[model samples]
Target chain A: MEKITSLADLKRIKEQVQSKIKLREQSASAEKLVQIRVGMATCGIASGAKETMSFLIEETEHQAIDAVITQTGCMGYCYAEPTVEVTLPGRQPVIFGHVNRERAREIIDRYIIKGELIDGMIPVNFKTIDE
Target chain B: MKTIADHILDIVQNSTRAGANLIEIIVVEDRKRNLYVVEIQDNGAGMSPEVLKQATNPFFTSRKTRKVGLGLSLLKQNAEQAGGGLQLFSAPGKGTTVQATFQFDHLDRPAPGDLAEVFLLAAIGHDKVRFCYRHTTGSGSFSIDTAELAETLGEVSLAVGEVRRAVAELIQNNLEAIGATR
Candidate 1:
């Protein structure tokens, strides 16, 4: 697999992904359905982000929280390298820091399931274009 | 490193950071049989035999800034905890493959996190590396070739907001079909 080196290369990749959109939709309906984002920046990896992310994935399926967990690069908070942002349907996105499997479970239970705010949040700073 | 995706993103970085020109990420989910597998392969400067053997140890790292390398070690642990396992294979100059498997029915098994976002990040974040993402669920599967996507968009960033949203929607629909819901 050669790394894509340019925007041209990326465009080509996206086109390939588009053809598979139908399959993706089918899979989503059959499997679990929650949106999870794990920070995988260099700092995050160094801080045990892998374990944290995997924990979230495994647990969601185990508990069946209607979830789809994925990874993102560099949330820009190096100090909180292993951070996780979870968003359930009809809920605001919540960012949790220093998360391990234990914390992941708590987030799933309290936030994802019960819609309760948990303790380890980094104050929201950046605003998306939507906001 | 507990979640499979987190572990994957971290490990994949090693390949990119090492100047890997091509990277492939494959994810398979089997609902009928109850299994989920993730494999990341890269053609970068592979680790030496000795380094490969020690890569799973928390204390061994190739980086100078840190005295410990917990990425692979913690990933292995997370896999085991979820009634799954992890493996790493590498050859100097050839490339490396890291695979992790989980029993979907196990109480410890995690859910499928957002993958579309991950794919976009991998494609857009690293301008010099090529990423190939293949996702499968039971009877169906799809692939994303960053190189191909780039070719289609032309003179524009293929990873634009629209592309990101579409990918996200695609993932959402796939998970839904599989009866995955939060």
Candidate 2:
């Protein structure tokens, strides 16, 4: 799939967000929950996102992490894909770059479980407008 | 090398790497003919002719981060080394098909890969994408269509624990039955 370039395109894409949110709501609950969002735009897939996502889900479930894994369309970070955004309950979200199975496990064990920051982070260079 | 199950997992992982949203994996073990065939089909943006020509070259990957793409090349080599052969067909917007056949008795033929886990992984990984996988041994066959399951389950996602377990168990039990015959 091609990139959704403009705000109009983003709006068109957001049209499906409601239904997707509904689907997600059926299971996802915030109880020390681990929320994993895989960057699933076409670029991510080309970069092996599917396999990475699968490995993460299997390993997380195998270890019985309180995780809810889901996919979101591009975040304009194609170069950083197959990217992953992890959010622990009551904590800020962190984005990780070039995620694979090995790194995924590390994230689960250290970051999710112990709240330690492992390497492989794509540094945040820009301060948010809100900040 | 691990079992054929591991190889299948690795290869199927490559299919997702190729941007395939729809993947169909078929495995057939024919005892009478003493042959085994595995086919992986995907509806993804396919390789261009130039890339297709060099797909087996190992050094000709389009990946910007990696120096080489070895997945398909390695799979092709493994198949050929085992007295079987590999065939790949692709078109730019159409999709790709990879088929490998092996003589069951060959020394290098790998053992059956962990297909059960493969389906489970796929069902969870690409819940939005559809995976239609079927396995047929000499005695019987097992098939799973995620699209069908999604339609049946209503708003519930396949990523849910119970659903993923059911799909995983279904593949495992069917595979166990097939293995029982031999």
Candidate 3:
């Protein structure tokens, strides 16, 4: 592709990105697509959330799964560094703790693809304002 | 938060959110001046003058999800605590540039942290946007542009597992070649 230099070109690309993200967002609220959020705080980074995130993003795409992966700040789960929250369509979001590349792949293959909930789940103990 | 790289990640997220397609991250270590400078320039929808005035205020935010924006404020505080400062230049409908400086050897200064991760995250998270990362340590310098990498890959997505691994290794190796260790 062409190198984005001018403001117009940048805006064009931004529109494309925004459209893709919009699809993901619409899917999240419409309960039509799987949504994944990887924690990327300082603690998460130190524990290798970057690798896990890359794995999920790539693996999901490679597997041809209709999932959107996004980054998030710390979830106050520092003890469970490298955490990931996965939300299947029409289901409650599940927070997975201590995720690595292997676990990321497993999440995609078993939990995400097959709807088989594996280990590394950090049980929700508190309620949110929306709740 | 704990490292300069973390601050960079936070600020760059702002750029991506601002609809930037090109984000440039420059790190310069000037031993002679005992200064470490990080500059993030983006061709995003810049802020209005009214918002620019309070971009560094912890109480200011443009997001509806929260009432306070602490990224720029925390970075400014970190730089100041290390005997340096942060500067933001932006214009409505133009773009934004954030320059943060820290004392090179200040005891309070945090390490640069994992920059390779930062680049990789930005690359994969914003696949459509292009990133240019340059690191300079008085000795030498190295720069990598995602657009150039994409040209080399020829239609391969950086989100691919092998490609992601290669990009991360390339960043690590290039930084090492230039003696930019964190």
Per-prediction TM-score of chain B?
0.89, 0.87, 0.96
- After TM-score superposition, the amount by which residue A113's alpha carbon in candidate 2 deviates from its true location, in angstroms, is 4.7
Two-way lDDT contest, 1 vs 3, winner = 3
For B1-182, candidate 3 gives per-residue lDDT tens digits of 77787788878778877888999999999999999999999999999999999999988877664466777888999999999999999997789999999999998888998897788787766777889999999789888888877765544445545555556666776677777757
Note the chain A TM-score of all models in turn. 0.69, 0.70, 0.73
Compute the lDDT of residue B24 as modeled in candidate 2: 92
Off by over 4 Å in 2: A1-66, A70-106, A118-131, B179-182
Instruction: Please identify model 1 stretches exceeding 4 Å from their true place.
Output: A1-42, A45-131, B174-182
TM-score of 2: 0.68
Tens digits of per-residue lDDT for model 3, A46-76: 6877678767877887887777677766656
Rounded to one decimal, what is candidate 2's iRMSD? 14.9
Tens digits of lDDT, candidate 2, A9-120: 3333344443453445555576667888876544565676767877887788678676877665455566787888887898777888888777888888899889998998
The best candidate by TM-score is 3
Ranking by lDDT: 3, 2, 1
User: Model 2, residue A99: displacement in angstroms?
Assistant: 9.9
Which runs of model 3 end up more than 4 angstroms from their true locations?
Answer: A1-35, A39-68, A72-110, A116-131
Give per-model TM-scores: 0.60, 0.68, 0.71
